[model samples]
Target chain A: MSRFSFNQITAKPWTLPEMVAGCVAAGVDQVALWREPVAEYGLDRAAALVRDAGLRVTTLCRSGFFQLPGWFDDNRRAIDEAAALRAPVLVLVSGGLPEGSRDLAGAREHVADAIGRLVPDAAAAGVTLAVEPLHPMYAADRCVISTWDQALAIAERHPAEHVGVTVDTYHLWWDDTVLEKIARAGDRIAIYQLADWITPLPAGVLTGRGLPGDGCIDMRAFHDAVDKAGYRGPIEVEVMNADLWERPGRDVLAATMTSFERSFRGR
Target chain B: MSRFSFNQITAKPWTLPEMVAGCVAAGVDQVALWREPVAEYGLDRAAALVRDAGLRVTTLCRSGFFQLPGWFDDNRRAIDEAAALRAPVLVLVSGGLPEGSRDLAGAREHVADAIGRLVPDAAAAGVTLAVEPLHPMYAADRCVISTWDQALAIAERHPAEHVGVTVDTYHLWWDDTVLEKIARAGDRIAIYQLADWITPLPAGVLTGRGLPGDGCIDMRAFHDAVDKAGYRGPIEVEVMNADLWERPGRDVLAATMTSFERSFRGR
Candidate 1:
C-alpha cells in the first residue's frame, strides 16, 4: 500500500508523538520525523512508542546544514543520530546560503562533497541520504538545490546505493518539465514529498506552502505520476504555512492527512 | 549609454502620443508599446509618432499564443506589424496549458513547433522573435517557458538569425543559476527587462511586483552581470503592479522611469 508521512509543517509545531497519532488517525501508515522531537523525547522511548502506535519511520527528518565552519563534524554527528534511531531514510534539508556569500553553485558543491564523504558512513549504517530540492525562490537564501535535476547531478556523482533525491510537489510543481524529470529520475528518486504550492502571502519560503487540496496544483495527477515512477517510497507531506503553524498542532496534522488522502490518493 | 525603455503598461489607456511624450520627457529612449495601444491609435500612426519622437521600438509587445487555435495567423499579423513599425524584437509569450491538457512539456513542444515554422517568416521580414518567460506562478495558466534553461533550449532548436530570448528579471530573479545562465547567454539575449519582487501581499500575483528600488533583488548586480555578458541591449522597465496599473498614465510612466534609474544603472 502507498502511504504518506506529514513532515510536521504540513501541521506545524506538532510533536513526533502527536504527528504519529494524527497520521494514524488520518489513515497514514508512515512518517518522516525530525531529530529535535526524537532528541527531546529520547530516541529509544520514541522508537518504542512509534512501533507501539503502528507507524513506520519512513525517514529521519534531517542532516546537512552544510555551510558552517564545522559542518563536516556537525553533519557526521547527524548521521550518527540517524543511525541511533535506525531510520530507513535520512532526510536532508541541505541548509541556507551562508553569511555574506552569494555563491550558490559553490554551496551546492560543498553539499555534494559533504555527502560524498558521509556516504560510506551512511551506507555502513544502512541509511540512505535523501536530498530534498527546495523551492527555487529559496535558491539564494535557503537550500541551493532547487530542482531534482540539480540534486541528481550531484547524486549521480555518488553511489545511488546510499545517495538519492526527494521529489516534493510544492518545490517542483512549477517546473515546466516536472513530469519528464520525474520519469527520467527513475530509481534514484528515493523519496516523493507532498505539499501544495500555495502562493506565499509574503512570497518567501519560511511560510506559504498549503495542504494538498487548498491550492491550484492538481494533486491527483502529481500523485499518479509518482506512483507510476515505480518507486514505492514515503510520500511525506511538508507544508510551511504560518497560519497552520499557529493553529492547534493536532488540527494541522489531522486535517493535512485527510486532504492528503483525498487529493493525493483519491482516483 | 544605459538608456531605458517604457513597457507601455506604465501608460495604460493613454494615447500613444501622450505616453510617448511623457516617456521622452522622463529621458527614456525607447518603448515596448502594447498591441492595444497600437490598435487604439492605428499602428502606422503610432509608429510614425514614436519614430518622430526619436524613440525606438525595442520590441513589439507580443506575437506568440500557440495553444489557441488560429494563433499562427494571429502571430503572423503581429510579425507583419513588427516589421512595419521597425521593432527590433517581437516578444513571444508562449501560451499555456491548453484547456484540458495536463502535459506542460507537450504544450511547450506545440509552442516551439509553432514558432519554429514562424522563425523563417520572421527572419524574412527582418524581425527577431524574443521569448519572454513569465514567472512560474503563471506556468499552469500562461506560458510554459518558465526557466532560462527551458527558453534557451527552445532558442537553440529554433534559432532564427532573428530568434532569441528576452531576459525579464521579474520572471527569473529567483533562480540561483541565473548569473551563470545570463553570462552564458551573452549576445543571444535580446531584451534585459527589469522589475522588482515584492512580498507580504495577498495569496496571489496581484500587487506582488514592487517598484524596482523598493524590492529585494540585487538589481545592480544583475545589470552589471548582463553587461559583462556582452549583451548590449536596452534595459526595458516592465511593471505588473495592480496599484500602478490603476494610477494616472503619466504618473505611472514617470514613477517607472525613476524607479528604473534608482534601482539600475543611472548613477
Candidate 2:
C-alpha cells in the first residue's frame, strides 16, 4: 500500500479538493493527476492543496499531441505546470496521424523529434518527459507510439533523466516480448501505471480499463519486470472505467487499494 | 487485377454462389472464403460453384481456436474443406486465453504445440497453415497471437511449405519494424491481406475495419514489403465494416475493387 498511488482518473467526477480529502481519508499518500482538472482547478492552487495535504504528485497526465497546431507551446506549459506541482514526471501520449495522412512512420519520426525539442525544457523543469505508448487500438487518433520498443527508442535518443518510457500495463500487456525488454530498461522507466486489460472494449476504447484483479493480465509479470528494471517509484492505479467512476471517490480509492494488494501482493 | 482476390467477408450477406458469380462478373479470378457460409452453402456445392466459375480459392478464412476443445479435429476439417476448394492456404487465428486463464505465455505455447500437431494433416492436404497475428485489441478474447514477430516465430518452427504467416495490413500496420521484417520473410508469406485501420471503433471491435484506402495504413508500403519478400501469391481484400455490410453485395464488390485499385495502383 505504501507504493500505491491513486490516479485521479479512477474517480472521474472527484474535484481536486474532494480527491485530496478522499485520498487522505483512505490513507493514500500519492496521486497521478490529469491536466484538464488541474488546469480547471487552477494549477498552482491544486499543487498547493495537494502539498498542504501531504500528498505527493506522482505524475501529471499528458501534454504531447504533436499533431495539433500549438503542441510546442502546450507541452512547454505542461512542463511548467509539472515543475510548479513538484511532479517528477509528465506523461506524453504522442498523438495519432494528422488528418487524412497514411504516414505512420512519419508520425513516429515527428514524435521523436518533438520529444527531442521538449527535452531541454523538461530537464530545466526537473521533470521527466515520460513517453507513453498507448494501445495500438488508439494508433489512429490517440497515439502513434503503440509499443514499448517505440517509446524506448525515442527515450534512448535523449538522456534518461530528461526522457523515459511510461510503462502502463493496459497499453502493453498484449506484447509477449515487452516484459523481457522492460526488465532490461534500467533507468529509462519513468513511471509505472497499472490498469488491467478487459474485453468488450466500449466505443472510443478510452474508459474501458479494468481494476487490476478484474481482468486477465498477470500483474505479477509486470511487477517483476518493473522491479527488475530497478524502478523504485510509486505504482499508480490509473484505471478509467465508467462503472468505477460512478462510485464515491472514497469507495473507488478503497477498491483500488484492495486491487493493488491483490495484484501486487497476490493476497 | 490478376493478383487481386476478393475475400468473402467484404460482402458478408452474399451467398457462395452469388459471391462466385459476382467475382466472375467483376473479372475477379480468385477469392478467400470463410468456413461458416461455406458449410451453410454445402461444402461440396460451394467448391463446385467456385470451380465452375473458374474462380480460384486463394485461402480459407480461418480455423485455429487452439484453446477450445476439438481444435485439432476442427482444424483438420477446415484443412479438408480448403483441399476441397483447392485453396492453397488456411489462415489460423490462434484463440485467446482459455475461459479464465491468465497464462498468456502458456496459451501461446499451447497454440504452437497445437499447430505442430496439425502440421502433418495440413501438409498432407497440400495446404499451408497461415498463422495470422490479429490486432492486439483482440488479444484478450479473440486471438492470442498479436504481432508479426509472434506469428513469424511460430511459422519458423515448421517447414515453410507447411506453415507460414499471414500479413494483413490492418493487423500489422502500426508495427514500424514489420515492413522491413516482411521484406526479409521470403517464402514464409502464405497470404497477404489488406484492411485499413479506421477511427472510432464500435463495440466488440470485430467489424470496424476500413476498405484499403479508406483509412490511415500505407498500402504501398505493405505491397512493397510483400513484393520484396518475393511473394507471388494473390492479394486479398478482407475488410469487415458494419457500414459496408449494409450496401448491396454488387455495390460492396465495386467499392472494394475501387479501394483496391486506389490503394494498390495508386490512381
Candidate 3:
C-alpha cells in the first residue's frame, strides 16, 4: 500500500481539494497529477493542498507533444509546474506526426531531438522527463513514441536522472519482448504506471483503458519485471475509462485500489 | 496497374461473381479473396468464376484463428480452398489471447506451435502461409501477433516457401524499424498489402482503415522496401472501412486504384 499511488486522471471529475481530501481519507499517501486540474485549482494552491494533506505527488501528468506549436515554451512551463509541485517526474507523450505528414521516421527523430533540447531544463528543475511510449494505436494523433525500445533509445541519449522511460502496462502489454526489456531497463524506468488493455476499443481509442485486473494484461508479470529492474518507486494506477469517470471519485479510488490488490493477489 | 490486387473485403457487399466481374471490368487481373464470401458463393463456382475471368488469385484472405475450437481442421480446409483457387498464399491472422486468459506469451507460443503443425499441410498444398502481424490495437481480441518482427521470427523458423509474412502498411507503418526489416525479409514477403492508418478509430477498432493515400501511411515507402526485398508480387489494396463497404463495388475498386496511384505518384 505504501507503494500505491492513484493518478488523478483515474477520477477525472474530482476537484483538486476533493481529490486531496479523498486520498487522505482513503489512507493513500501518494498521487500522480495532470496539468489541467492542477492549473485550474491554482498550481501553488494545489501544491500546498497536497503538501498540507501530507500526500506525495509522484508525477506531473504530462508535458511533451513536441509536434504542437510553442511546445518549447509550453514544456518549459510544464517543467516549472512540476518543480513548483515538488514532483520528481514529468511524463512526456511525444506528439504524433506533424500535421499533413507521412514521415513517421522523421517525426520520431524530431522527438528524440526535442527531448535532448529539454534535458537541461529538466536537470535544472530536478524533474526527470519520463518519455512514455503510448500504444501504437495512438501513433498518428495522440503520440508518436509507440514502443518501449523507442522511449528507451531516446532516454539513453541523456543522463538517467534528467531522462527516463515510463513503463505503462496498458500501452505496452501487447509486445512480446517488453517484459524482458523492462527488466533490463533498470534505473531508466522513471515511473511505473498500471492500466489494463480492454477489447472493442471505443471511438477515438482513448479513455477505454481497464482497471489493472479487469482486462487481459498480466499485471503480476509487469510487477515482477519492474521489481527485477530494482525500481522501488510508487506504482501509479492511471486508468482512463468513460464509465469509471462517471462514478464518484471516492468510488473510483476504491475500485482502483481493489483492482490493484487483485492484480497483485498472491504476490 | 499490373501489380494491383483488390482485396474482396474492400467491397463487402459485392457477391463473388460481382467482385470478379468488377475486377475484370476495371482491368484488374489479380484479387485477394476472403473465405466467407467464397464459401457463400460456393467455393468451386467462385474459383471457376475468377479463373474463367482470367483473374489471378493473389492470396486467400485468411485462415489462422488458432485460439478457436476447431482451428486445426478449419485452417486445413482454408488451405485446401486456397489450393483450389490457385492462390499461392493463405494469410494467417493468429487469434487473440485464449478466452479470459492473460498469458500472452503462452498464447503466442501456441500460435507458433499451431503454425508449425500446419506447415506440413501448407507445404503439401503448395500454399505459403502468410503470417500477418495485425496492428497492436487488435492484439486483444483479433491477432496476438502484432509486429513485423514477431511475424518474421515465426516465418523464419519454417521454410520460406511454406511460410512467410504479410506486410500490411497500416499494421507495420507505426513500427520504426519495419521498413528496414521488410527490406531484408527477401522471399519471406508473401503478400504486400496497403491500407492507410486513419485516426478516431470507430468502435471495435476494425473496419476503419483508410485507402492507401487517404491516411498517413507512406505507401511509396512500403513499395520501395518491398522492392528492395526483391518481392515482385501482387500489391493488394486491402482496406476495410465501413463507409467503403457501403459504396458500390466498382466505385470502391476505382477509388482504391486511384489512391494506390496517388500513393506512388512521383515515385
iRMS, all models: 4.4, 0.7, 0.6
Question: What is every candidate's C-alpha DockQ against the true complex, given to 2 decimals?
Answer: 0.24, 0.87, 0.92
TM-score of chain A of 1: 0.90
Worst window of 10 by summed lDDT in candidate 1 chain A? A197-206
- Candidate 1 lDDT score relative to the true structure: 0.76
Worst 10 contiguous positions by lDDT, candidate 1 chain B:
B198-207
In candidate 1, what are the lDDT values of residues B1-267, reduced to their tens digit? 356888887556667888888877777778887887798789899889988898888888886878898898999999989988898789999976777565666788888788888887798899888987787766766677889888787887755357788888777876767777888786678888888765544345545577777665668778877887888878788877777877888888878877877875553
- True-contact fraction in model 2 equals 0.86
Deviation in Å, model 2, residue B42 alpha carbon: 0.7
Query: Model 3: runs farther than 4 Å from truth?
Result: none
C-alpha DockQ for predicted model 1:
0.24
| TM-scores computed on chain B for all candidates | 0.93, 0.98, 0.99
Which tens-of-lDDT digit does each residue in B144-242 have in candidate 2?
999999999999999999999999999999888999999999999999999999889998898899999888899999999999999998999999999
User: Rank order by DockQ, top first?
Assistant: 3, 2, 1
Task: State what share of the real interface contacts each candidate retains.
Answer: 0.25, 0.86, 0.95
What DockQ score does model 3 reach against the true complex? Answer: 0.92
Give TM per candidate: 0.77, 0.98, 0.99
TM-score of 1: 0.77
Model 3 chain A poorest 10 in a row by lDDT: A197-206
Candidate number with greatest TM-score:
3
Better of 2 and 3 by DockQ: 3
